[model samples]
Target: MNEAKKNSHMVGTVSELSVMLEYAKRGYTINLPTTPARYDFIAEKDGRSVKVQVKHGSTFNGERELLGFSKTPYNKRDVDVIAMFDSNDGTIYYIPTDHVEGMTSIRLRIEPYLYSVKSEKALIAEHYKKFIG
Candidate 1:
């Protein structure tokens, strides 16, 4: 049987669900908002809650990729954390919105580029894994 085609909205929903599952597995209580809002979920644990915005990541070069948090900037009040689901490896990375405050997107590197002497500081996705849960 042929698989059904997926569009952006469908992909986004899948990403949100995937992130929700991950959060649940990590012992978080996932709460979905009833109305359309800036954040996708409100994850709570130990009496603490975080507003999470889910974004899908696309891979470019084999070693590096970019994840767009928003077309426009959003304040920390709108989203406490940005959960990026890597399409390539099924890895979900959590980043506090404050880290990329006022930015539209972030470039993620799998590893350092040794040959480039003036390489920009890399935002490795794996490093952000610590923010999960």
Candidate 2:
């Protein structure tokens, strides 16, 4: 494989491992599917299962953390939650599928000073923190 593809795969694998660790730390049982699945893995707790799709968060234009979902169309039926790990901040953001059902990409500000007031209003970092669990 080319260097870029190899690097991307490595980042994705690391992000998935990070998400699995986070779920395990929260007392959830991690289950890996034996067959092809839409979501990456399932986190089960109290008999409830949450389908998770993990994406490696990357910096865009050296400012915002960009989470791209171009591999597939956003389908709420495919997964319950989307876990994005920001390598820059070492932080993970858990976003429900419903919130981003039809979106192709999500941009998050890693540094406050890099965003404008108008864009900042809609990209408040605090809004996504509550869903970290």
Candidate 3:
């Protein structure tokens, strides 16, 4: 029986969209480039700019989340910082862009996750998924 194909696009809209918005709320300049592209947004804050491959776990749950955080060997292009985030609860875990072996849609990369920021603006919110680091 053809169980109705689950609509993936709708979920991506909810999750990835939330991730982008949360980044902006925290004062990083945000950008959404044309789709069918390499990454989702470019976030610049504290004099740093990054090519973020934003992932919506519920967004593209066909295993792309695994693509983002696989702790394996990879080429140098993956060195620009990568992130796997759960925006709903405002928690994102990231690492150097080259940690994972392969590439896929979703997995994001942002740098300098740890630093001394103004106490009032620290990203101390909670997230659901046990995000990658």
Best by TM-score: 2
Q: Give lDDT per model, in order.
A: 0.78, 0.75, 0.47
TM-score of 2: 0.84
lDDT of 1 at 114: 58
lDDT of 2 by residue, 100-132 (tens): 777767666555554344463234444566543
- The alpha-carbon lDDT assigned to residue 7 of candidate 1 equals 75
Clashing pairs in 1: none
Highest lDDT: which candidate?
1
When sorted by lDDT, best at the front, the candidate numbers are 1, 2, 3
Lowest-lDDT window of 10 residues in candidate 3? 120-129
Provide C-alpha RMSD values for all models, in order.
3.4, 2.5, 11.0
lDDT of 1: 0.78
Q: Is 2 or 3 the stronger prediction by lDDT?
A: 2
Candidate with the larger lDDT of 1 and 2: 1
lDDT of 1 by residue, 33-112 (tens): 99988899999999999899988886667746655548768679799989888766778888888887887876666555
Residues forming the 10-long window of minimal summed lDDT in candidate 1: 113-122
